[model samples]
Target: MVCESNSTQAAARQLGINPKLLDRGQQAQVVAEVGSEELALDPEIRALYAANKWLAQEFDVLKTALVFFGQLTR
Candidate 1:
């Protein structure tokens, strides 16, 4: 897995949007409205999105497992 220490910058680059534009918490709306258009035009972004989605799902599973096993201390 790639280290995403600068996730916002990476996401902004992949979405072809300015990172500053997302400061107002409008990234979701912007993506929802234009994501398809952008995805169709850029295969790289689509691939990145897919990978990110997979990573997120995997992360969720790991978190759930850790919680179930009581490995994650509060």
Candidate 2:
């Protein structure tokens, strides 16, 4: 309701609360949002590293198979 109000002061008055408290709550919300976004990056980086490791192993297997088939054909 405070977000939809035309003014923070008026919203606080209507709700019978302090404007400063409402302002602090808003500030805390912004900080939490920023913190959450930063924390989210770690998982994404871990997932990429895992994918890279899997691809490297797959390439080594395919290389060995190609060598074996090459020797048989010759």
Candidate 3:
């Protein structure tokens, strides 16, 4: 579980798989091939990662709201 922002890429590289394919959710095979090795990031890194994920979800919600309002105006 290499938990860097580029974890998928790193895992793909470590397992000699293509990063592009891995990014498309080819993780199960990668995990099967490499087994699970946990990442050892600091608390700050973990917190930042969690914050980024949350922000992404919030952005999606905002986009949906904009689309909804746009449809209502039309």
After superposing candidate 1 on the true structure, give the runs of residues whose Cα lies further than 4 Å from its correct spot.
1-36
Clashing pairs in 1: none
CA-only RMSD, every prediction: 12.8, 16.7, 11.3
Give the number of colliding residue pairs in candidate 2: 0
Scored by Cα lDDT, where does model 2 land?
0.66
Off by over 4 Å in 2: 1-41, 71-74
Query: What would the TM-score be for candidate 1 when compared with the true structure?
Result: 0.48
lDDT (Cα, tens digit) per residue for candidate 1, span 1-56: 12233887788798898777654344354356445555534657756776887999
- Across 1-74, the per-residue lDDT of candidate 2 in tens digits comes to 22434598888788898887887676565446446534434556546656887999999888888888895342
Output candidate 1 Cα RMSD: 12.8
Worst 10 residues of 1 by lDDT: 22-31
Query: What TM-score goes with each of the models?
Result: 0.48, 0.40, 0.42
Model 1 scores what on Cα lDDT? Answer: 0.66
Order of models, best lDDT first: 2, 1, 3
Q: What's the residue-level lDDT of 43 in candidate 3?
A: 47
Residue 59, candidate 1: how far off, in angstroms? 0.3
> How many clashes in each structure?
0, 0, 1
| Per-model lDDT | 0.66, 0.66, 0.62
